[model samples]
Target: MTLKLELEQYPFVDLSAKVAEIIEDRFAIVLKSKLTLACMYLDPRFQCALDENEKKIAKSYLVKLHERMEIKRLAKLDASPDTDSRSNESDNSNTRDENENLLEKMLQSKCNQAKNSHQKKILQLLNEFDFQSERTPTGIDIIEFWTNNAASRLELAKLAAVLFAIPAAEVICERDFSTLNFVYNKLRNKLNDESLQCIMFIKSNEEIFQMQ
Candidate 1:
């Protein structure tokens, strides 16, 4: 919507219209990006910031994505070699743990009385969280929050890991070149590739180490 509004504010309607059309076409592909969707879904800040309707949209895609993942998991399981005694024991142990988890959730739901649907539960948690206030006071502990909840939110944690692994923008590579220019100036020309990489890593994440 903001992008649309920005385009509308352009002086040339014809150019804006053409640009908007291109954006619309590209935006469809962006929407289909599971990694982006997963990141948005798992990010506490994004969850708190997005409106209810936007949350619904993310949830709809995430649910479908989860289902697709499950299908792939089952296919992989079917393709695996037959389990012997050791594997069978491991399966039994996993089943026991799962049953225990089910019992615990059953007890918790009974106490709560009204179990919301998965979608609503996620949205409710997101909406109820005071991420903005917490961020202003202390830094946003997004990784910690996800890590602590990872056991119960296993799929979301997996999604978060995959999403976080993706590069957010191509500009990062361009920025690295800029860093290289600064690091490999006339006096530093003798630095080898390995040394350059070491310097780049330190430069890129200097603030994080500084904080520690």
Candidate 2:
């Protein structure tokens, strides 16, 4: 759109049409990625740009990702040694105040019910999310929005974290390789593997150390 406006203002500009065509081609290739499409659907600012069918496809992909994460979470919990200890501790608490025990049981039941309907919970989240509402401020941080505002919805928040952690481009990886070139030059070729890794770690996180 910006290029289109520029062309309107100065139609004789050399290679303007070629530049616009290249940009459009790159965008078309990006749109073919399901991950990119899903991210757009999740981002409130651009969600409205997707049509109904695209939205449905994005939602399905998100649900599948969430379900996979949910399975891994449950598997970890089941494998934990603490589970047996906690159950034994709960049995020892049977002699506590009757009303308090009843309340705990009720809360546990509610949590179990919530865990059983992960799909339903996701549907509810989609239905209830309204970025146009007064509660959502403009220029909000997407990661912070999911982590803080949706803290109560653990499954959704975890899914968002996993999705957003994926790098959109290979720039970071390329930067790392560039850094390695400087660190492991011909003069420093004798550096051992462990020493090289240590230097890289400090170099990569120098900004973080400075902030502290």
Candidate 3:
């Protein structure tokens, strides 16, 4: 369990996601992971042979796992005046305890390390432009674009959104690349701008252009 949790850490979030996609086992593993936590008291033998004591212990362990996951979920809610004050306080404590999520720490550390050069460059450029800190433009869009497009520090962020939205991307790319290569290769020496356009039309199976 500790190893699984550790494997889940850092600027390395997409590692787990990529592995999960590659193996197609993340979902199946999660389902069985919960079962394993409760496996201690769950005898493989028939229940008819077991007494009430063993059954009770097995049920208790399973319930405990659900309770742990549930408490963590409830902790993420915004504080509300209407919230049950007692449960809300308990959730807050449980939330803090569960927040040992090490991924955030690793990401921040990596970002800090990467920032040394980029930040220095930004400061130097600003100084060169005669823009003092007070006059410098600071906005969310500017920073977002700088980090995402310029520095490329946040490229994994773009990929994470894509990975979550589209599973099994590697397989799709693998299947299409062969067809693209065949189309391009067949046009080799015969290819000029006009004929290349025609080949692309043929490659994409646009029959109207082919007829023309």
How does each model score on TM-score?
A: 0.44, 0.65, 0.19
The per-prediction tally of clashing pairs is 0, 0, 0
Q: What Cα-based lDDT does every candidate model obtain?
A: 0.67, 0.75, 0.45
Candidate 3 lDDT score relative to the true structure: 0.45
Off by over 4 Å in 1: 8-12, 37-148
lDDT preference between candidates 1 and 3, better one: 1
- Which candidate number maximizes lDDT? 2
Cα lDDT tens digits, model 3, 1-212, are 33455555643678875654544555446434423323322222222332345444444444444445434656767444565656677657766656645767886788677655544543333223222222322333432433454344232233223223343237746545665577558547566778766666566556566798
Q: Which stretch of 10 consecutive residues in model 2 shows the poorest summed lDDT?
A: 129-138
RMSD of each predicted structure: 11.2, 8.6, 27.9
State the lDDT of candidate 2 residue by residue for 70-176, as single tens digits.
Answer: 77888988885766666777666766567678989998898678765877778667655533332434488888877785657676677678888888789978888
The candidate with the higher TM-score, 1 or 2, is 2
lDDT of 1 by residue, 86-171 (tens): 57766589787888799999988874553235445544544443244343212566677778878977767665665576676788
* Model 2 spans with C-alpha error above 4 angstroms: 1-11, 75-116, 130-138, 184-198
lDDT accuracy of residue 6 in candidate 3:
53
| TM-score quality measure for candidate 2 | 0.65
